[model samples]
Target: MKEQLNSLVLKYQQTNDEKVFKEIYKLSVAKFHPTFNAIAKSLRASVDEVFALYEDVLLRCIPTYTGEGNFENYFMFSVKNKRANLYRDRKLRTQKEVLECCLPKDDDTSAATLEIISEETPEDTLVRKKRADQRQLIRSLLDQTDETTINIVEAFLSCERPTPTAIGKTLGIHHMTVIRKLEKLARNFDSKQFGDFRDYLIAN
Candidate 1:
C-alpha cells in the first residue's frame, strides 16, 4: 500500500491531473478510514464530522505535499494536529459555557447543571489520558506477540470490513491461518476486556 501510494503521489505531482488526484484520494480514504473512525470514537464525535475534517485536510495538504518524507507519516501528523486543534476549540467552548452559567441569571439556570459542568474532565486532560492508555495497551499487546502475529494484527485493524478472509488476503495467508493466529493472540491478550478485538483495534 505504501509503495502504491508513493507511485500515485508522484504521478499526481507530475501530471497535476484531476483523475490522478481523485485516485489518490480514493486510495487515501480506503487506507485511512479505520484511523478516522478510531479518531471519531475517541473524540465522541460523529463519523461524518471526522470524515469531513479529513477530506478538508487532504484537499489542503495534497497540493503542498513535497513527496520528501513518508506520505503516511506526513498525513498522520496533520491529522493529529487537527485533532488537537479540535480538542482545544472544544475546551474553549466549554469554558465559555461555564462562564455563562456562572453569570447571574434567572431561575431557569439550575445548580445541578453547573455542578455537572464543573465535574466534567478538561478536554486536554481527557485526550492525554486516552492517548496514554492506547499506547500502553498497544505496547502490552506487542510485547506478547511475534512479528508475524503483529503483522496480522495490523492487517486486521487496517481492513475496512475486517473478516478473517480479508485479513488473510491482506497478509497473503489462508483464512483459517488468520483465524488460528487471532485465536492465539486472544489467548495471549484479553481481547474480551475491550469488548472484542475490533473494539480494541478502534480504541488504539
Candidate 2:
C-alpha cells in the first residue's frame, strides 16, 4: 500500500495529474490520521486543527519527496516540526496576553471603561509596540535568508532543539560549520536594525 502511494506521488509530480494527486492526497490523510490524532491528543489540540497542519505538510513536502526514505517518516518529520512551531507561536501569544493582563491600569478615571483605557502607561504601550516591531523584524530577516540557512535556523529553533551535530547530519554539513553559520547569522542581526529581536533570541 505504501509503495503504491509512493508511486502515485512520483507520477503526480511528473505528470501533474489532478486525479493521481487527489488520490495520493486522500491516501496520505487516511494513512496518517493515527499519527495526527496522537499528536493532537498529546498537545490538547483539536483534531481538525492537527489534520489541517498535516495537510499543509503534505502540500509542501510531497512534491519534493524524490523517493527518499519512507514517505511516512518524511511526512512525520515535516508535520512534527510544523506543529512545534505552531505550538511555540501559540505559547508566545498566551504569554503576551498574560503580560497585557498584568499591565498596570489607570487609577484616576471615574467611568470604568474610560478608566481602563487611561490606566495603561506610555511605557506599557511602547513595550507592546516594540515587541510587535521585533517580531516583524524577525520575520523580515528570515525571509531574506537563503533556503538552506532558513531550514537550519528553523530546525534549531524548533522544540526539539536538535544539537548542531544532529542538524548538521540532517543537512549534510559539518557540526562546526553549522555553529559558525548560526553565529554569523546572529551577528548580522544588528541591534540598530533589529532592535529587540537579537535580545529576544539571546534571552530565550
Candidate 3:
C-alpha cells in the first residue's frame, strides 16, 4: 500500500499525464476525503476551497511522506497549515485596516522615524584599532610578569563597577596587598613604562 502510494506520488510529480493524475487523485480523495473534509471544516473553509488552498502544499507533502509519517500525520499537518494561514490572514487584514486609516504624511516625521530605526554606532568600532594596540601592549607587558600578578590584574579589571574591598576579597588578599600588587605592576612588567597603571586598576 505504502509503495503504491510512493510510486503514485512520484508519478504525479514527474508524469505530465493530466487525465491519469486527476483519475488517481480522485481515487485517493475517495479513500481520503473523510480525513480531508474534517480538516477543511475545522479551518472554516468549504471543502472545495480547502482543496484549492492545499494544491501546492499537497504537491510538497508528497515527498514528506517517505513512508515514515502516515496519513494521520499528513492530515494533521495540512490542518495545522490551514489554521496558521487563517490566523495570519486575519492579523494581516487588521494591520491593513490600521495602515489604511493612518498612512505616513511627510518627510520630517519619516526622517525622525528613520533616525530612531537606524542602527546606533557599531560598538566601540572607531576606537577599536587604538584599543587593539593598547590591548597588545597590555598583553605583552603582562606576559613578562609572574602568573599571580597577571591573575590579580585580570581579576581587578574584569569588574565594571569594581571596589577595592571587593577585589581584595576575590584575590584573598588584603586591600593594601591588592593596591601594592597594582602599584608594583609597572615595575614587574617594565620598571619605567607609563603613568600609574595602579590607578587604572584601583576603584579608590
Compare the candidates by TM-score and give the number of the best one. Answer: 2
Better candidate by lDDT, 2 or 3: 2
lDDT of 2 by residue, 1-204 (tens): 778888887887778666786677667765766676777767656666675566556755765698976776677788779889878866765555422233336755544332222356565787667656555665666776677677776665542335455678888986555544654465567756545323433222
Each candidate's lDDT (Cα)?
Answer: 0.63, 0.62, 0.53
Please report the TM-score between candidate 3 and the true structure: 0.33
Tell me which of candidates 1 and 3 scores higher on TM-score. Answer: 1
* Candidate 1 positional error at 38, Å: 4.2
lDDT of 3: 0.53
lDDT of 1 by residue, 1-204 (tens): 766777777787677665676677677754677776777777656665576456545544665578787676677688779788776766666566652235446776555333334544576576567556655676687787788778877765555446555567778887556645655665555644654433454332
Clashes of each: 0, 2, 0
For model 2, name the residue pairs that clash.
105-119, 106-119
In candidate 3, how many Å is residue 124 off?
A: 3.1
Q: Candidate 1: where are CA atoms >4 Å away?
A: 34-38, 99-204
State the TM-score for model 2. 0.45
- Kindly list the per-residue Cα lDDT of model 3 for residues 1-204, writing each as its tens digit: 545555566665556345544544544443655675786666655555454344434433643555554544574588568668965765664454422233457755653222222333444364455445445556777876677667776775566434444667787876445544544565554425544443344322
Ranking by TM-score: 2, 1, 3
TM-score of each: 0.44, 0.45, 0.33
Q: What is the lDDT of residue 49 in candidate 2?
A: 62
